[model samples]
Target: METFAEVLIILVVLTNLKLLGSSRATACIRTVAAQGVLLAALPLVTSGDAITLRMIAQALVSGTLKAFVLPFLLLRATRGARAGRELAPFVGYTTSILLGVALMPLALALGRKLGVTGPAGADLLAPAALFTLLVGLLIIVCRKQAVTLVVGYLAMENGIYAMGLAFAQREPLLVEMGILLDVFAAVFVMGLVARHIHREFDTLDTDRLSSLKG
Candidate 1:
């Protein structure tokens, strides 16, 4: 169980780095989807047998929504947006990767100082979660593309979901489901807005939106 959890954490961290470095919208969306899939498996790995039939069903629902449903929407939006990549980011890819590398140690140290309560491999969870969260924030702040912002937002939510599992494994099923639903709705709305931007301006670059006077 510990080993499995550790592997998942590592994958999540690697995915975060991949996201930071990626400029292609399609690749970024795919990485976020992979992150969601890993997050879904986290519960089973961290909590040995607290798994009820309901829990299993819940996992399937959350996983399917994050991994498939949401990405499909974003991809559909992208097709209409007609943008292939984030051509210019406020922070360059190299700098973003450097920041991610630096942030990892800080996250690990902070996690240790904060004294996270969980099992053996759980220590890794906090750092990985924090690292991913920061990476996501970086994406949101640095990228100019609307689609990239959506992807980054999902990445942040993924980090939050993973940390929630690590810290509150026994949280009620309803509460977990609620979080997933809220995220689903938020993503849905964001996709619509992205599509609207494309329709209105024929471009998905957020940089252009700033030219609006109102």
Candidate 2:
């Protein structure tokens, strides 16, 4: 169980780097979906031998939304907007990757310093979660596309969900459900706004929004 948790955490960390380095919007979306699948498995590993039906339900919901439903929504939004790769970013792709690499150690150090503990099988969850959050924030700040920002938001939510899974046995099921619902609503609203922005500007690039201030 510990090995499974460690592998999942490592995969999550790699996805974070992939998100930072990827320029193609489709690729970024896929990475986020992959992360979702990984996060969904956390409940099983974290639960160890005491897995419950409620945990299974949560994992199913999380995987479906983060892996399939949310990505489908973003893909539809992307097609409507005619957006693909970001092309150019506020931070270059290579630099962004390097930054992510730098952030890994920092996240670990921070996690250790904070002494945030997790369930038996999820010891590495805190650092992995922190790294994912930072990567998502980087995507939001450094990328220019509205779709990319949406993906970043999802990634950030994944991180939060991962942290929750680390302590799954203690957290209430209702709280997790609420968080999932809120995320769905947020993505729905953001997708609509992104579609509108594309229609109005004829582009999904958010940098173009600066011209609207006149």
Candidate 3:
């Protein structure tokens, strides 16, 4: 079971790297959806039969909504947008990958220092969660597309979810349900805003939305 959790954490981290490096909007959305599925499966991997039915149901809802519905909506919005070019990243691909590589050891060190003791200890969960969180932050900072930012947001949520799974027994099912609900609401609002941005600016570049500056 520990091995399974580690594998899922690796998969999640790899998917985050893909999301960071990929230029195509469709490809990024698909990758984010894949991350969501991995997050949904994470609970199962770490479960110790102490998990309740309500928690299981919450996980299912989170998986379906995050993995399928949210990404589907984002893809549809992407199609509506006129911009088809790869995302204009503030940092080049090679630089971003290098930064991600550099950040890995930092994340591991941070995890070790934090000494987060879960059912599996910090060995599997903490470093991966920290790395994913950093990748999400990098994406949010560098990507100029709203869709890409949303993907980054989802990546951050994935990291949080991974961390939450570490304490799945202590976490209330209602809290998980609320988190999913918040994510759903956020995605819905972002989709609407994406559509509006496409309609108004004739493009989806997030930089352009800042024209109201004084």
Candidate 4:
């Protein structure tokens, strides 16, 4: 179980890097979908022979929503937005990758400071969760694309979900489901806004929206 946790953590970290480096919005969304899938598997890996029906349901619901439903909405929005890749990001791709690399060490230090040993006390798990959360924040702060922002939020939520497991905190199934639905609602609204931007301006760049004034 511990070994599986370590491996899953490494994979999640790699996906974060992938998200940071990729400019194609579709590719970025796909990367986020992969994160959702990995997060869904986390419960089973950490169950440690105590897996229950609730755990299975949570994993299933998380996988269905995060991996499938949400990404589908984002992809549909991206199509409507008619933008292929991020351009004129506040942070360049190279710089974003550097920040991602730097975040891992900082996350490690933070985990140590918090004395988070992780489930089964695995040293890498907690820090990796923090690293993922930071990477998502980096995406949100650095990119101007609306779809990218949604992807970043998903990544951040993924990190938070992972953190709960890393710190051995399990949320009730209803609470988790509600959080997922909230994200879904937010993304649906954001998707509509992105499409509106495209319809009004023929582009999905938020920086351009600054033209809206009193």
Give candidate 2 misplaced runs (Cα > 4 Å).
Answer: 168-170, 211-214
In candidate 4, stretches whose alpha carbon ends up further than 4 angstroms from where it belongs are 212-214
The CA lDDT of each predicted structure is 0.85, 0.85, 0.79, 0.85
- Could you estimate the TM-score for every candidate? 0.93, 0.94, 0.92, 0.94
Candidate 2 structure quality by residue, lDDT tens digits, 1-214: 7888888889999999889989998899999999999989887886678888977888899889888888888887888565877778899999999999999999899777756678776778988988898889889999999999999998888887776665444457787788888888898889888888888899899888875554
Candidate 3 Cα outliers beyond 4 Å, as residue runs: 48-51
Deviation from truth (RMSD, Å), model 2 = 1.6
Point out the higher-scoring one by lDDT: 2 or 3.
2
Judging by TM-score, tell me the better candidate of 3 and 4: 4
The sequence of per-residue lDDT tens digits that candidate 4 reaches over residues 35-131 is 8889788878876888888888888888888788888888888885667888789999999999899888899899678877666636787788888
* Candidate 2 lDDT score relative to the true structure: 0.85
Model 1, 150-202: lDDT tens digits are 99999999888777765765568788778888998898999999999999889
Q: Please, what are the lDDT tens digits per residue for candidate 3 over residues 1-214?
A: 7788778888988987787678877888899899889878776667657677865777689789977899888988898575455545788777887888888899889877777766652366777888888888888888888888888898888887776665544466576677788998998899889888888888888888775866
Query: Where does candidate 2 clash, by residue pair?
Result: none
